[model samples]
Target: MCLLIAIIIYFLFILFLSTLLYPMPVNDSGITRYRTIPWTTLILILINTVIFVAWIGPDMYTQEAGASGTVEYGPSPDYMGKINYYGFRETTLHEGIGVAAFTTFTAMFMHADIWHLFGNMMYLWTFGRRVEDACGSSRFLLFYLLSGVIANVGSVVVTPKLDDIPSIGASGAIAGVMGAYLFLFPGTSVNCLWGIGSLIRLPIAVVQLVTSQQAKFWRWTVSVPAWMLLIWFVISSFIPSVETIRSDQDTVGVNHLAHLAGFFAALTIFLFVRKDLFLRYLQGRSL
Candidate 1:
C-alpha cells in the first residue's frame, strides 16, 4: 500500500510538472454582469481547498505512532479506509440506491492528492465565476451538486465492473462549469499560457526584439475561442472513453466518461440560468 501511494504521488507529480510545457487556461474574456463578486465560486473553491488541506491532509501525511516513542509521517490507514468507505463505489451502487447516491455528494469534495485538488480548483476558478454569475449563487450551487451526482452515475454506468474502485474528484463538476461557459459565453475567449517557448528554452530575446506587442504576447500566451476549447474537452474525453470500453481494459485511469456526462448534463443550464439570460440566449443576442 505504501509503495502504491508513493507511485501514485510520483505519477501525479510528473503530471503536475508537465503542465508547464502545455497550454493552460489563465483567464477568460467572459464577464459577470449579474454579480460583481462571484461569492459562490469563491466559497466553493475555499471549501474544497479547506477540506483537502484539513480533512485529507492526515490521509496523505499522517504522523504514525512507532516504537521508542517515535512518530513518522505516512499515509494513514484509518483515513484511507474512511475514503473507501465513503467514496462512491460499486458495492454502494449494488446494495442500496440511497446510500450510493449519498456517496456521490461526499465524493465531490474529496480529492486524491494536492495535484488532483489543484488541477480541479484551477479549472473551477477559470470557468466557474462566470457560470455562477449567470445562474446566481444558489442556483449555481444546486447545479454544481446535481452535475456531480449525474457525473458519478455516468461513470458507474460506463464501468460497472470495477467493484472496489472508488470515484472521487470535482473534475466532473468543473467539467459542467466548462460546458456552461461554452454554452452561455460562446463568444468569449479563453486566454491560456503557452509555455512551449519556455519548455524548449527558446530565446525570448528574438521575440522581444520584434516591435509588435501582440507578437511578444503571442510568444507566451494564446487566446482560444471558448467553444473550441470546451468542445475539444468533450471530444478528447469521448475518444479515450470509447477506446477504453472497446479494448475491454480493466486498468484504472481518468474517468473520461464522467467528464463527457457532466459536459452534456450542463447543457441543461438553460433550466438553471437566470430567466433574463436564458431569454437573451434564446433571442440570439450577445450575452
Candidate 2:
C-alpha cells in the first residue's frame, strides 16, 4: 500500500511539473458507461508515460557536449540516432516511403520531453475515455493511429520546406480525440488547469473541492463546455499556423497545422462510432 501510494505521488508530481507550459484537462463532466472501462485510453497513456520516463527521458541532455547524463552535453548520438530513425519527416514520404509509413505509427509514441508526453496524455485521458466508450476499444485505437498519420501528412503537405525536420509526439492523435469529443459530447464540461508550476496540482485541487475545502488551487481550474474549449484550441492552432507560414522561419516547432488536420480528420468518427450511437447522432437524438 505504501509503495503504491509513493508511486502515485511520484506520478502526480511529474504531471504537475509538466503542465507549467500549457493548460491540461484533468477531468470531464460526462459519466462513463456502466461496467465499461476505457482500457485502450488508459493503455495508451501508460505506454506514452513509460516510453518517456524509461526509454528517452533519462537520456535527455541540453548542453553542447560532455557526457550522456551531464547537463552540459547534448543528446548522445544513440539518442539522436533513435530520433532520426523514428521521428517522422516529410522527406521520407517520398524517399523511403515504407519507413515513412512506419514512422507515422512510431513517432506518435515518441515524445521530445516529459512536458510533451504529459500534455498529450492528459488530453487523451480527458477526452479519449468517452470517445473510446463511444467507439469501442478497437475502433478508437484505429482512429487514433490514423489520425496521427494523417496529421503528420497534413503537416508535411502544409510546410514542405521543413521536410527534413522530424516531428514527434501524440498531440495529433489526442487532438483527434478532442475533435471526436466535440462532436459526440459538445456540451460536456472539461475541467482544465491553467496556472503556473505549483499553482496547478489538479489532483489535490480536485480532492480539496470534493472535501469542501477551498484552496488557492480553485483559481487554477476552469470548467468549460467541450465545444468552447475545442473551438478555442482549433482557433489557437490556426493563428499560429498562419503566423508560422508568414514568418517563413526555418526552424522546427509545434505542428499547429497537423493539429488542425487531425481535428478535421476525426470528423470521420461517424465511421468508428458505435452503430447505435451513429444512428442516434444522424437522427438528431442525444447520444
Candidate 3:
C-alpha cells in the first residue's frame, strides 16, 4: 500500500512538473534591460554543481557501504539513511551546538538526488539573475546566504522537535529569489513554456508510454506577468504548510515553513530598502 501511494505521489509530482511554467526574463523582449552580466548567478550555479560532483556525487554514483553494511551504488537503497548520518540538520540537533550550527549551513549545500539539484539550479537560474541585476552581485550573494540560513532556522523552529528527519536542498533560497522578483519585477512579462514538453520531459515521456492516449504533450511559449507566477507559488506553499500543521499525516518531506520564511525575509528586505525600485517598476519605469 505504501509503495502504491509512493508511486502515485511520484506520478503526481511529475504531472505537476510537466505542466509547470517558469519565468523567462530573457525572452521577455523589451520588458527588462539586461544591465549586468549576471556573473553572480552563474558563479552560484557553478558552485552548487561543483559541490555536488565533488562531495555528494561520489556517494551517489559509486559503490559504498549501505546502512546494513552491504555494498551498493547508483541509487543505493539506504542513501537517505546514509546521508542523514553525515550532517543532516534534524539529527545534528542531538549533537553539540557547534555541530548543529555547522550542519545547518552544510545542509543548504547538500541535496538528496540529481533531480533535486537540477530543479533547484533551474529555479535559481530563472530568478536569481534578475534579482542579482536589481541588487548588486555582492548584495545578492549576501541576500541568498542569509535567506537560506533563515529558512533553515525557520524549519528547525516550526518542525516537531522530536522528528529527526533530515532536510536538504536549495528550494527555500530559490523561493527567496522568487519573492524578491515578485516585488522587483511585478510588471515584467516573463516567457514560459507550457504543456508536457516542458523542462521535466524525460519523466513525462515515460508516463506517456503507460498512458499514451491520455497524455498530451505540446511545446509552446506563453508570456505571463511575474506577479501572477510568484503569487501562485507563495499560495501553494502556504496551503501545504497549513495542512501539515493541522494533520498528523506523517508527510515529513518538503519544509514548507522554510520556504515561507525565506520568501518573507526577502520580501520584507526589499520592501524597506528597495521600496523605490518597486514604486518605479509599478509606474512602468525602468530601474
Best by lDDT: 2
Using alpha carbons, what is the TM-score of model 3? 0.70
Cα lDDT of model 1 by residue, 13-51, tens digit? 675466555556767866678755888888988998999
How much RMSD separates candidate 3 from the native structure? 9.0
The TM-score-based order of candidates, best leading, equals 1, 2, 3
Q: Which residue pairs collide, candidate 1?
A: none
lDDT tens string, model 2, 22-113? Answer: 55788887886534699999999999889888988887764574466644756767678667888898777678843776888889999987
TM-score for each candidate, following the candidate numbering: 0.81, 0.80, 0.70
- After superposition, the stretches of candidate 3 with alpha carbons farther than 4 Å from their true spots are 1-17, 20-34, 61-82, 85-94, 196-219, 248-252, 271-285
In terms of lDDT, which candidate is stronger, 1 or 3?
Answer: 1
In terms of lDDT, model 3 sits at 0.69
Cα shift from native, residue 100, model 1 (Å): 4.0
The residue-level lDDT of candidate 3 at 113 comes to 71
